[model samples]
Target: MPIDRLADLADAATAPRLVVKVGSSLLVGPGGTVRGEWLDSLVRELAQARARGQEVIVVSSGAIALGAARLGLAKGGRGSLADAQAAAAVGQIALASLWAERLAAHDIPAAQLLVTLEDLEDRRRYLNAAATLARLLKAGAIPVINENDSVATAEIRFGDNDRLAARVAQAASAHAIVLLSDVDGLYDRDPKDPAAQRLARVEGVTDEVHAMATGASSSGMGSGGMTSKLQAAEIAERAGIALAIVNGTHTAPLARGLSGEGIGTLFLPRRRDGARKAWLGGRQRMHGVLVVDPGCAAALGRGGSLLATGITAVEGDFGRGDPVAVRDGDGRTLAQGLAEYTAAEIERIKGRRSEEIEALLGYAPRAAVIHRDQLVLL
Candidate 1:
């Protein structure tokens, strides 16, 4: 799987989707102000990518850094996690508005999405996120994504935007993920070492690659380092996505990476089009169970939608967009789909016709309890 840089450029230029991850160092200056000019250039890069028929999704980090100085936690050793979390809460507003403003200049609508690991960890939430992100892409809007650090504890948080970006790329079915970082690419040893060497490309992230891993960075506000980027690269590789770690200091950073200019290390996936199916077939854990009649089970097996009429009983107090299991009367799992209605809502609509939905609940979000596209038959 040795990557052909020029080949990658050609392939990526025609790719339907791309996810670019912007580290905090690229977004904020040492003075703690948003790097407007840098962001403007990045926006222009995205605009050009869009013109080439590529849908661009951005995962930006800098919220906590943006808030640190403002909260008087600026002049210090890396502050506590709680302090960083507080900063993230306040900085998210600034970060979102800044992206919106920058992209607006090019008539590119930027939609902000703040997510935690839980959003992608839970099967239902992952489906819900995938659907919403897909909708935004279909509507010709660029998603400005960021990690939700405000409530994420160390045990539950992704910690770095790199891994989070990988998950976003997988969920969005992106063709490539460009990690815009301070460094140019992977090195044989610490770049500071006199004998260090930079590898232009890597085919796989093996044990040897892990041995080359470094610790947290010294230059930026981000907590992640080259080791984390490699970790993220592996995730992208497993999902059949190409990952590039390029220096964000340069103008048109993403463009250079995708154009096959050999600006960074590119990690190629082992296979194309099958990683997603294999991952999905791994039996994702679903939260709730919905017992349906035989007819409903047959319909599901045929790739039809789950309707309220087919539902006979519900178990578990789940909310809208939660993944629920579809089972038969004997309790055998039939399929799994994200719920359009909450447990209570489903309870009231069970065994009711689509026509009776509006009258019973005064309104219906959708006719089907679970859309056909979201349901996965077991």
Candidate 2:
């Protein structure tokens, strides 16, 4: 498609749900103080979008900035992870308060939602968070989300809000994601070089674009660089959401980008599956593996539920409710499912009948190894 047609589709996307991510550089000044005026303006624009009957969610990054300023930490200091976590603990509260106050001016209520990677990893928690955000949007409330840095361990950290924003966009079934950062848009080369030029549009994250992405800037406040931004774009694009990377320095750049004013680099959306299928496609990790016989593989290929009789082996330690990969005898993953039995139980009852399960294990909760509803054919 032509760039103009793509821009027109993005403009039409304004009527649907949108996720806007603002980086730390946009929300803080050089002195590490919160830019209340800039935040207020951003909130006003978001409110305007809401007034147009669009649902807007903001994934903001400035907790550490606010916290460092409050704690009088010197910039570029080599602080321990514990110290940084402390700063986040302090800043997150202040950051939420600042946003709440700014949003109040527009007569819009903003709710703060802090989440860790674990929240998205756990199936129940993931669905709960999605439902809560949906309800808040339906009630005309702006949901402001941030990483729960205060208590998030290294293993569970989201690292940057860019990726988190893409996850939020997928969870909300957003039509578009606007990522506002210090740089205006992606460049063919380092924008610092005189010969470098901006790429106004991208259909996908091609190999050429991947080669052009450099590391993080020397700026101490922000964690994510252009490379992380591209990774986030890839996530949103795969889920079939248009993504825009614009300069946060430009006031109301998000609104302008959505209006097809050509202020940022736009990523065209791909054909999408429904939201649940998209979520399944992007699952980050699987818990265990279920190796099946040829018959079971053929059954799954024909959209059939896995049965215990066809099970040849089970590998890895996993709980009954955890998600696991279903593989064929040669060790190729054929599907993913929520296992009805634990790995140990599967070992004891492999190739057993429902009647035999009770004789061997005292009881049988289910006949199928994994019911059809719990299985996703790959």
Candidate 3:
């Protein structure tokens, strides 16, 4: 896509549902204080979008930075996982309060939504989260989302808000995702070097651009780098959500970028899947593994349902109605399905006939371990 064409798309996006992600570096100033002026400007733009009748959700990163400032841990280059977690706990409160005050100034109410990987990974949780956000939007409130860093472990972490933003875009059925970062946009090489040129628009992320992206925050306040931003863009693109990476430091960049000013790298949206299917595809995180026999694996590969007799072993502690990965005995994942039986139930009845399920479990809600309609072959 050309820069001009992307400018046109951005203008069209003004009234569409949007998910905007702001990095920690952009939200905080030197000495770790909230950049009041920057946030005020950003909020003003968001208010404008809302005035245009666009529903917007913000995925913001700055809790840890604010927490560090509040705790007087201002000059550190790095910290332990414990330190980061503690900072998040303290800062999240401050972050929400700050946003509330800012939004109030514009007569817009802001709501806080703290989510972990499990919220998106679990189907029930995912639906609940989506419902809450949808209601907030319907009630004319902007939701400010952040990772629930207080209790997140390495295994169940979003790693960065960029990925979280993409997931939110998918959850909200957003039409676009605008990522405001330090750099103006993606470049063929390091933007710091004079010779490196800006990539004003990308129809799709190519191998060369993927290779060019490297490193985390030079400011030492956030974990996300250009690489993670690119990955987030890919996720949004796959879901047919338009994306923009603009310089957050610029004055009113969000509004300017959306007005066809051509100030960022614009990623064109791909052809989309059905809304329900796209939500299901992006929301479920692999919960447990069900090792199936070779015959079952082949059947599933051919888009067949998983029967009770096909499962050899169940791993992990997932409940009935949770998403589980179906793998062969060698441990390669063949498909993902909504398990009809709990892990405990599957363990007891593995390799049994479908007719035997009622007798063995006292009740059988489903004859197959996973019905074909709920299972997606990998």
Q: At residue 58, give the lDDT of candidate 3.
A: 93
The lDDT, on a scale of 0 to 1, for candidate 1 is: 0.80
Tens digits of per-residue lDDT for model 2 on 214-244? 8685365788988888888877776787788
TM-score of each predicted structure versus truth: 0.71, 0.76, 0.76
Ranking by lDDT: 1, 3, 2
Model 3 residue runs over 4 Å out of place are: 1-15, 74-78, 193-195, 204-209, 283-378
* Candidate 1 lowest-lDDT run of ten: 275-284
RMSD list, candidates in order: 10.2, 5.0, 4.7
User: lDDT tens digits, residues 1-378, model 3?
Assistant: 222344543443442678889988888887787788878899998887787677889999888888888887644323677777888899999999988999998888999999999888766787788888889999989999999987887888888899899888887877788888888888888888899888887876667778989766666677888998887876676577778888888778776665645677888755465555455455436779999999988888787889989889889999988888888988776677688888999998899887888898898548588888777654
Q: Stretches of candidate 2 above 4 Å error?
A: 1-14, 74-78, 285-378
Q: Count residue pairs with overlapping backbones in model 2.
A: 0
Q: How high is the CA lDDT of each candidate model?
A: 0.80, 0.78, 0.80
User: For model 3, how big is the CA root-mean-square deviation?
Assistant: 4.7
